[model samples]
Target: MNFNPVEILGLIAAVFTTSAFLPQVYKTWRSRSAKNLSLTMYLVFFTGVMMWMVYGFLIDSLAVILANIVTGFLTLILIYFKIRYKD
Candidate 1:
């Protein structure tokens, strides 16, 4: 688990970006409303994230893989909420 400076920077960036969705997920879950969320956008974003994950695996990048895995999970939750809380 030896990370170079660049990888460390990447992990930092990944932490920020991946955690960014927490508030939205919490809000959606607590409020039980996703009428304002765009399903199409999330679907597209999820697809992109999946691609990034694949790229990460191919490149053997830990930061990208970890970040996308968490992001993908959060995105899935948002998608589920969007469908379940559809108004």
Candidate 2:
């Protein structure tokens, strides 16, 4: 599969955006504290990401699809943590 420069850029952007949640996930997991996290916000964000993933699939965009896949998983984990570690 050949990728254009634009696609390459999208991949790079995707990496940054998707990895941005790592620190929060790690902190929440390690601290076992999700009291500060907003369930509403994460729920909305997860919904949006799922929509974006669908859009990506519709458009046949690998970067968007991959990024959303990872982001969705991370968001789900955070949601689980929030529910499981409720204060």
Candidate 3:
């Protein structure tokens, strides 16, 4: 696949945005504590991510599609943890 500079930048952006959630996922997985996490925020965020993924698909954007798919799952994981760990 021939990638232009813009695509490269998009991939880089995707990497940053997707990886940003890793720390929280790791922490939540290890500590099983999501006390400070906001369920509303995640719900909104996940919905937005899903919408982005759909938009990506419609536009045939690899970076947007791939990134949002990964990010969407990560957000879902957070949501799962939030609900599972909530007291």
Candidate 4:
């Protein structure tokens, strides 16, 4: 209810970070090609995102929780596509 500058900044940052993955997600989904993606990098990143979500919960950070949840789902989809389309 109270306005917090830090929380506002966090939400703004979350928007940018979460949206950064949209291009890759769209490309992979539309082309069904993930040959250029790194499975290891995604796995690590997803794990980190999940951890960030947990950390967000522990800290009661709504922006972090929401952003990571969406990001994690997108990352998981990429991971799935990577495995499914592997040559």
lDDT of 2 at 14: 94
Name the best candidate (by TM-score): 1
lDDT of 4: 0.90
* Candidate 1 TM-score to native: 0.95
Question: The CA-based lDDT of model 1 is what?
Answer: 0.95
Lowest lDDT block of 10, candidate 2: 1-10
Error of model 1, residue 53, in angstroms:
0.3
Q: Please write out the lDDT profile of model 3 over residues 1-87, one tens digit for every residue.
A: 338898888889999999999999999989989999999999999999999999988887889998999999999999999999985
**Number of the predicted model whose lDDT against the real structure is largest:** 1
Q: Report model 3's TM-score to 2 decimal places.
A: 0.92
What is the Cα-based TM-score of model 4?
Answer: 0.89
> Cα miss at 35, model 2 (Å)?
1.2
Best-to-worst TM-score order? 1, 2, 3, 4
lDDT per residue for candidate 4 within 1-87, as digits (tens), equals 223998888888888988989999889989989999999999999999999999999989988898899899989989999999885
The root-mean-square deviation over C-alpha atoms between each candidate and the true structure, in angstroms, is 1.1, 1.1, 1.3, 1.5
lDDT of 2 at 79: 98
lDDT of 2 by residue, 13-82 (tens): 9999999999999999999999999999999999999999999888888989999999999999999999
Q: Clashing pairs in model 3? A: none
Q: Score each candidate by Cα lDDT.
A: 0.95, 0.94, 0.92, 0.90
Whose lDDT is higher: candidate 2's or candidate 4's? Answer: 2
- Cα-based TM-score, every candidate: 0.95, 0.94, 0.92, 0.89
Q: Which ranges in model 1 have alpha carbons more than 4 Å from their true place?
A: none
